[model samples]
Target: MKQFPTHIVAVDGIVENEKNEILLVKHRDKEIWTIPGGQVEIGENLTDALIREIKEESGIDVTVNKLVCISSNTGTYEGYNGYGIVPTKVMLGFTCSFIGGELSVSDETSDSRWVSKERVLDYITNPNLIERFKAYLKFDGNIQYIEYITKPSYDLKLKIKI
Candidate 1:
């Protein structure tokens, strides 16, 4: 049998409140702010993972409405042996509706709050995340596909509404 490359499956949610503010969270170790989400555990479905992640990280309840976009990127990280290993991550971004829950931070997150769309870019500075935010803003009941590379250089290979 031929060995196939392994890819990480991650999920993120773009949650908006009735006030037209977006939910954002800051990780304990990261400076930039991002939407609430994390990796999917083994045997867990995408939507379930997203719900669990959001609840754990931001103490917010959200309902996954629809998939807004999918992004694939390959990045390098330090391995256990101090060697660099490249891994591909396939992330699904979803549009979620805020259900209920008091906004609070978990151990994984330092702060959580709703930010206006105009100020989102001020908090989210990562190029890739900025692109994803743009897709969320331009989502018109259609799914988008974004392909990019983040290790060697941040290059957006393809972005199209499908």
Candidate 2:
């Protein structure tokens, strides 16, 4: 039996404009549109990391207004070199407000856009993102902390949206 490698800590920035449009980036490497964020750096605050990621990916600066949601994700990716590996990821989803900066596509993204929360489906590569976007819209400042243990592969956990 081949054991899987453990996943790493990752974060995602969900920046919403005044009109409630969430920003997304289509990465050239993956060629898939996703939230504007990456790894949660060691010893850096989550909000800070998210802001930096957003700026680097979409040329947009932001302030994390609140935590929108959290998810535990795990999957397998076949490397281009013909090696297969399990990619386990724990992602923190934030609902951020765009503070400043113009929308310019960066090196990390081949394209970028602001889409309505309800229309995240139109832009996202992952199907479950719509569930998180729904929680971000109805957030009332009282709810915080969504924890899930994703294991056995493909058994994603859903909670913290109360």
Candidate 3:
């Protein structure tokens, strides 16, 4: 019998401004546009990891409002392929309130900006990226569970509030 390794835990923040726009960051290395977040280090709390990641990537302060959804990539999303062939990531998504900070980019992020719901598609072309925001739009203040499958397309999303 073999022991399975621990799954990587990640956090994504949906930071919204007074204009009702969401913040997205472009990965400096990957060039992929997604919500600001990263892997949670060992011994770090989920929310704390989220705050640190957002600030590190976007240089902004945010107050975590509520958990939006919990999703498992299960080798479907290639963006988290940093671990090589074995892809397993549990992502905790949260709705955040923008506190204050000047727009700045970190080494991990090439660009950071706010995008309206309608204009999100213009910046993010990845199906997985688009689906993330769409899931948030349908968020009804309930926790959503998502499982992604990339067969025909990246739209294989199953979101259910439990």
Better of 1 and 2 by TM-score: 1
List model 1 lDDT by residue over 54-113, tens digit each.
999888999999898899986655555564564788999998989999899988899999
lDDT of 3 by residue, 1-162 (tens): 998875779999999999999898999887988889889999999999999999999989999988878887665334444644445778888889999997789989899999886787788876665666777888887777887755446545576776
- State TM-scores per candidate: 0.91, 0.75, 0.85
**After best superposition, candidate 3 residue 119: deviation in angstroms?**
1.3
What does the lDDT read for residue 126 in candidate 3? Answer: 68
Best by lDDT: 1
lDDT of 1 at 102: 86
Model 3, residue 12: distance off in Å is 0.3
Off by over 4 Å in 1: 75-77, 80-86
**Residues 1-162 of candidate 2: C-alpha lDDT, one tens digit per residue:** 997766767778778798988898899888998888889788998888888899988999898876667666645455456756646566777878898998888778898898887788777755455556656667777443444433433344556644
> What is the alpha-carbon lDDT for the whole of candidate 3?
0.82
Q: Lowest-scoring 10 consecutive residues by lDDT in candidate 3?
A: 76-85
lDDT of 3 at 1: 100
Off by over 4 Å in 3: 1-5, 76-85, 149-157
TM-score of 2: 0.75
